[model samples]
Target: MPILMLIEYFRATMQQWSFQKRNVAAEAKRTLTPWAETIIQANKNACNNWMVYPISNSRFVVKSFTHKSVVVDFQQRTCTCSRWQIDGLPCGHVIKVLTMSRYKDCSEFDFKAYFIETLRKNYEESVNPLPSPLESKIPGDLMIVKPPMMEMRQPGRPRNIDRILSQGERPIWQECSTCGKFRQTRSDCTSRGSRSGISQATVHIQR
Candidate 1:
């Protein structure tokens, strides 16, 4: 029942998300919102304090007044500062270069992942509702599982322990009295017909 509830909850969430995406996509005229444009413009205006050196028609080097420099590549849509490739948005360095190259719209330099068409296509598919699994006809070849098996082990601390030791601590090795071997307890000793230790223990108990 919990599994069914989980599947139903996810289905409902997907439906809701699809609806929201469709609405936002329909209202979107451009990739960047007005707020994003405002931020980009603010950065573009601040670029006046930076120096731009054009390396080629597609690449340029930008340096801030603070002596920090970064490379901007238009063909690759990447900046050395990495904001252009990471966030799919142009960094201030790229904006500075675009202005020098006489590009009027800075938003056009954004990656296709941030495009309005991509946003519209992402939510085009509708999420369908699921029927009850118990009511549905299941295939005969489907593998079924059972939980009738019993746990045969005791519920308590075990004697044979295998774990890491603490710092500067030596390992504790066990020696069996019957087998006279390391790491084997007397109960699991494999020395055949070794009853001398048991006879002496019985005699001590009787005395």
Candidate 2:
């Protein structure tokens, strides 16, 4: 499914699950468990560090939350810890300090957006083409010896519809007479129930 469709499905599910309560405070009080709050606080704390400071207009200096020994550059927004690069989110050390200082509401800009922009810029810089002379030089020696390309195999065996039609498909479910629920059909059920003199209307599944 498309991302937009998936997002809509999630929104619909959330709306269905939301309780029909009038007061927002009442809803929060009912839903907010102590354990949930602790987890939220822990996640917030993970994104902070003392070394984490906005160094200049575009740069920030930080240290790794996972590895205290490894310092980092938040301006370039990178860390020795791969988590920063993999997820492109502010690491634990940055998050912890940001929560502590309450820098989220600051007038300059949102730190989250700044952090994302830093990673985006880094990705853009990596994809930018090199100068023409250097680009041609790197591929020249490698492309000289042409390796023989292997032939790719086609997909699986073709269907034999005639053979399939010869073997009839089995019925999966039988409708229950007593209740509407589906039950496995037994060949001897009619005889067995008649011998026992049980009311067919009240008959229950053997299983």
Candidate 3:
């Protein structure tokens, strides 16, 4: 299903590219990807939810409605929330701080990864359609491989007793009736007790 989706995406991308006269980078810039535009819009909306307090020309503290505050350092390009550092895109706190500092464009601070040129380069490669199985050629020198043998199950309802025993309906170890111990039978436990008694008798004789 994932492979089919990828094939469909490649087909659609190639179909769209066929209509474009200009290069992929130019075409990509003309129309921004949905995800890039979405992030931009989200950051813009989030600016209203934040309150910016200027610490210096490059440092700021942005407080949200929930009383959550994060420090934004423009010079370092980092936010205490760590989103800006990880994603390479200015998060809500950074955006709010930048806006408070009278920075007109927030996109200048966005990472190169989100740039249209980067996106264009990623999709620039052509994916050719595969040849039909009928047209596919196999080397004559290669050995022919046969399908694996199928093992047929016995034609009866499987015994539930074995399944139950395997699943712990019956205990694997037998308890010794003589010593109340597991794994050994009553006769084996009696023999062990006799050996211990003999050892104790020998020690007493030596003493």
Top candidate by lDDT = 1
After superposition, which runs of candidate 2 have C-alpha atoms over 4 Å from their true positions? 1-41, 47-66, 96-102, 105-207
Query: In model 3, which runs have C-alpha deviations exceeding 4 angstroms?
Result: 1-32, 132-135, 155-157, 160-207
Q: Give TM-scores for every candidate, taking all chains together and pairing residue i with residue i.
A: 0.66, 0.25, 0.60
- lDDT scores in order: 0.75, 0.45, 0.68
How many steric clashes between backbone atoms does each model show? Answer: 0, 12, 0
Instruction: List, residue by residue over 1-207, the lDDT tens digit for candidate 1.
Output: 798899899999999999988888889787665446666777777788888998888889999987578999888888898877777777889888877778888768776666667777888998989987877997899888888889788889654434555576665566667767766567655575544343221111110
lDDT of 3 by residue, 19-62 (tens): 35225455555334547668767877977967878888889888
| Candidate 3 or 1, higher lDDT | 1
The alpha-carbon lDDT assigned to residue 104 of candidate 1 equals: 83
Ranked candidates (TM-score, high to low): 1, 3, 2
Q: List the residue pairs that clash in candidate 3.
A: none
109-204 per-residue lDDT for model 2 (tens digits): 223433323333333322222244435555455657688899887799743423322244533355555444444234324434533443223223
Predicted candidate 2, C-alpha RMSD = 23.7
